[model samples]
Target: MTALPYRPCAGIMLIDRHGRAFVGQRMDSTLEAWQMPQGGIDPGEDPLAAATRELWEETGVASDMVEFIAAPDQEFFYDLPEDLIGKVWKGKWRGQRQRWFLFRFLGEDGDIDIATPHPEFRSWRWIDPAELPRLVVPFKRALYEAVLAAFRPYLNTQIGIEAVSQSDRPR
Candidate 1:
């Protein structure tokens, strides 16, 4: 059935100093696909806050270690595959409606620790932003493409670096 509502979620696209996006291989999957930090938003919680928390919970990256870069004008949505629609998320959601936020990592790579209290990733690494769709699971490729397109102007560019650096400066 196509009537199930998508879960409201937030996603974090953290960019390292080299301007690559962070991706993680799922601990529960046998496939080679990877994904960024994302999770359902708690009731009454702001999406930005949810994104921040998800990033920390999944990657051990605190809010202050990164600078907010930019967010697209829209949210991205994707549906689960036909065979697994009822096998995930307690079979409650059709998929996710994700609000993605871009953040520039200000700390050293050592600051990142995927071995969190409750880890979801088996491994993690930074990759070129344009390759996100190819690295993600098939179901979420389109969503990743849209995210990459929306943030293309800022990713891996000197303008984006300057902008993020400027924002971190004292008034």
Candidate 2:
């Protein structure tokens, strides 16, 4: 069989004032499937704009409350496990090719309301970037790792703190 094409998508790494990344637990998941806010890029939409829109859709954090940090030099791609190949995204996609952006959250915690017009996550929290790759579902781990690496330099820039290694969790 021919390989399915990857869906074009954008991902957000929303960081709070403390430099912790935002992760959400999927409502459809039975396991601890936490992930950064992400979604498909609409036709003719810019990836960074899609990232901002996805953040609002998934976290209720508006574009005004966030500032762009940086994007990876290249998009990262991930394939779903064989069991999921023909079951997800209406089987139109093998997985996703994502353009990731880091955004610094400027609003207070009260500004976030995950109960958007359409909700995807059941619960959400701020986590250390190093914990991100471990918390995400297994198939998406490498993607998260690449995101972490790409966004590591800017994690402390907004907070004006010492830089943290992408692979090292804070003590």
Candidate 3:
């Protein structure tokens, strides 16, 4: 496992107006693990495009329904547990190297429909950003923590005494 390359991937942390992040339970998993939208970055594909594509594939949230926020200047990585190293992803990769994006969901809940043509989630909901790590599988806790740390500033900020809206964000 140590010798295998990490799979390239993109992850999305969709934020609601209340500063919560979207998470979903994997359809095939028996564990109580819930995770943010993420999936492999196809060969030669831009990570941002992959994030947008994966968002629709997993949660039925289209790019137009969300506004791009921030992405870490660096990538995050996590390795599969020993038992999973040789069994997942055709044993080709040891883990994933992810470029995570934060996007503000612009539409109402009705705009999201997880029952896609190729659904990856069983159920989904918005969660407090601070609770992310505890909700995910143990192996991904660190990655989630790092993501929170990186995106914390933008989640909600006070420039003085006023709250900024999406319109105030730079183009």
Return the TM-score for each candidate structure: 0.92, 0.90, 0.91
**Residue pairs of candidate 3 with colliding backbone atoms:** none
Clashing pairs in 2: none
lDDT of 2 by residue, 1-171 (tens): 147899999998888878888899998889989999999999999887888889999999999998766776688999998898888888899889999877778999899898988999999998888899899999999999888887776766445334434544211
> Taking the tens digit of each residue's C-alpha lDDT, what string does model 1 give over 74-132?
87999999888889988898989999888988888889899999999999998888889
True-vs-predicted CA distance for residue 10, candidate 3, Å: 0.2
How many pairs of residues in model 2 come into backbone collision?
0
Could you tell me which 10 consecutive residues in candidate 2 have the lowest summed lDDT?
162-171
Model 2 spans with C-alpha error above 4 angstroms: 157-171
lDDT score for residue 25 of model 2: 96
lDDT of each: 0.87, 0.84, 0.87
Which digits, one per residue and each the tens of the lDDT, describe model 3 over residues 1-171?
799999999999998877878899999899999999999999989898999999999888889998887777699999999999878899999999999888888889888888999888899998888899999999999999999998887776322112336554322
Candidate 3 segments exceeding 4 Å error? 157-171
